[model samples]
Every structure is written in C-alpha cells, then in structure tokens.
Target: MTLTLTQTAAEAVKQIVARVPQAEDGGVRIRDTGAPSGFELSVAPDPEPQDTIVVTDGARVFLDEVAAASLEDRILDAELAQDGSVRFALGSQV
Candidate 1:
C-alpha cells in the first residue's frame, strides 16, 4: 500500500523528472510481471528491439498487465554504488 524511495532512487527519479515533460507526476510506479520468473513495469507490453527494463519519471509507476500480480508489497530503495551508480531495491508491499 505504501512504498519508500531511497535517497539515490529519489534523486534518480528527480533527475529523470527534470528531463521529461510528461513525468510531472513526481513518482514512479513499480509493477510485477505475472511470469513465473520475473516482473516488468508499465501499463502495456514490453517494447520491441530491446527488452531492457524501462523506467520513467511519470507520476505513476505503471504495472504491466503481467507484472501487477507478481508484486504485492512495494518498497523502493536505492544504494549509491562505489562508482556512484544507483541501485534500486524492490520488495513486497507489506
């Protein structure tokens, strides 16, 4: 029901928000794919060419049709890598 954003994650999201004109929502939605293996994010199917994870600064973090059911508890955390890379942690909604 509630999700927490790590400082790095928040900064990343904020940076993304600054770039995109549509991401005025100011939050990211994380969704789970119904697949037995993993999850994806979005309100629609994954795009072609590359199946890489897609993230945006949109106010809403959409859950792909398949991802919605896989994830229940939602917590967004970030880790500042030694190289300054940001890592995100996704967990149950509990």
Candidate 2:
C-alpha cells in the first residue's frame, strides 16, 4: 500500500484540502481494482477497509489493510491532459 505523491498531485491536494471543511480528516485513497493497466485512485473521506493509501496532509501517508496485503509498491502520479484536466495514475512498482 505504498503511495507516492507527485509534485502536481501534492500541490493540488494541498490546495483543495485547504479550501474544503473537514478536509483535514479526508484523504485520497488509491487501490488496485485488478485492472489490466494497473490501479485506480479514489477520493473520499478517509478509508474503512477498501482503501489503499490514506493520505493525511504532507505529514503521513499509509497503506490500508486491504491494499497493504495486496500490492507491495505503488506510485501516485499526476498527468495534465490536453483538455486542461488533471488526472492521477497509480502503478505497481513490482
């Protein structure tokens, strides 16, 4: 359930969290849906049992139970599309 934060994603998450209330408790969750590409990332209010990485600010990022038991390494990257949309990608380092 290791997660990497790209400069773009870290900056964006920092900005968005700053604007929203209760964001201090919320975080971005990354998980592998067992897809062919790699993994899928989801944004939600913390994690229960289905979350991979529970990111809390720039201080700490961790792997949830499920994800930790599954993937060993993962990278969270940010991409800027031609349509002016920013997207996130998660891939297994293994």
Candidate 3:
C-alpha cells in the first residue's frame, strides 16, 4: 500500500495547516469509513497509533491501515477553482 501526493497538493496542505491554528504541528489524515464504503480526510495533530505515514514534499499524510490499502498506487492532487477554493482529486497511478 502506498499514498502519493503531488507537489501542488503538498503546497496546498501546507497552506491550510498554516492557517488552521489547531493544525500547526499536525498533518493530514485519511481514514476509511467502512460502513459508508468511503474515506474521510481531515487534519490531525499527529499520526495516530499504527498509522502509515507518507511524507511528500514536506507534507505529512497519515493513513489508517484500511485507507492505506484503499489508496494503494494512487496519487492525490489539488485543483483550484475559479472561486479560489481548493479541491482534492485522487487518481490511479499510471
């Protein structure tokens, strides 16, 4: 299992963490929501116990075991909308 982040995504995450007071020393965490058959992404103060940590371009991404498996061989990217909002995109690695 692996998690990859694009340069833009890493920059975006860093910017967000800088703005969010509670996430100063934190990183992004991805977890699987088994019941809903989906994933949840949020900022965490640090990696939880037994989390898989992936560092990319200075951004730390923490993934639970399920999330790690789910996102294997995938890349995470960031896109900016016309309104300046950031949107995260996940794609399979080619």
Candidate 4:
C-alpha cells in the first residue's frame, strides 16, 4: 500500500510533530472509523504491531491495516482557509 503527503501537508505535520514532547520516537497515526465512515489522525508514541508505516520527507505516518488499504491510492494535503484555519484534504492519486 502507498500513502503520500503534499509538500504543504508534510511541512504542517513536521511543525506539529516537532512540538510534541517525544516526537523523535513517535509518529502520527491514522485510523479508519468504520462506524461513520471517516478517518481519525493523531500523534502516537509508536506504531502498533499491525500498522503500515509511511515515511515522508519530514514526518512519519502510521496507518493500521484498514487505513492503509483505504488510503492506498490517496494523497494527504493541507490548505489554509480564509479564516486562517488549517484544512486537510484527501485526494485520489491520479
């Protein structure tokens, strides 16, 4: 499975990770929530046994088996809204 992050997203994640206390040994985890058919992202101390690790330029993203498959051909992107809030976008690899 493959998961990618845009330059903007990578930069944003890197900045957030840097501020985390144990970021050096931890990474971000992305999980699929079957109930509502959505995903959740958070910082994790480490990847779980069944996680699929995606290493980007400046950050590491850990995805569980289901999440990895769900995002196999997707790209994670970040954008700044008019209100100055950060928004996350998921797109097809094409």
Query: Residue by residue across 1-94, what tens digits does model 3's lDDT show?
Result: 4978999988877776776798897888889988664788888889999999998878888999999988999999998667756788899998
The best-first sequence of candidates by TM-score reads 3, 4, 2, 1
Clashes of each: 11, 0, 0, 0
Model 3 gets an lDDT of: 0.85
lDDT of each: 0.47, 0.55, 0.85, 0.82
Q: Tell how far residue 60 is off in model 1, in angstroms.
A: 6.8
Using lDDT as the measure, name the better of candidate 1 and candidate 4: 4
TM-score winner: 3
**Residue pairs of candidate 4 with colliding backbone atoms:** none
List the pairs of residues colliding in candidate 3: none
Per-residue lDDT over 1-94 for candidate 4, one digit per residue giving the tens place of the 0 to 100 score: 4989888887767666666888666777899987575998888878999999888885788999889999998999998566645677899988
Supply candidate 3's per-residue lDDT for 30: 88
Which stretches in model 3 have alpha-carbon errors above 4 Å? 35-37, 82-84
RMSD of each: 7.3, 4.2, 1.8, 2.2
Model 1 clash number: 11
- Give the poorly placed runs of model 4, Cα more than 4 Å off: 80-85
Candidate 2 structure quality by residue, lDDT tens digits, 1-88? 3556666767556554454566565655555566677555444556655545434347223355555666456565667566655676
Name the 10 consecutive residues with the lowest summed lDDT in model 1: 43-52
If scored against the real structure, what TM-score would every candidate get?
A: 0.44, 0.52, 0.86, 0.84
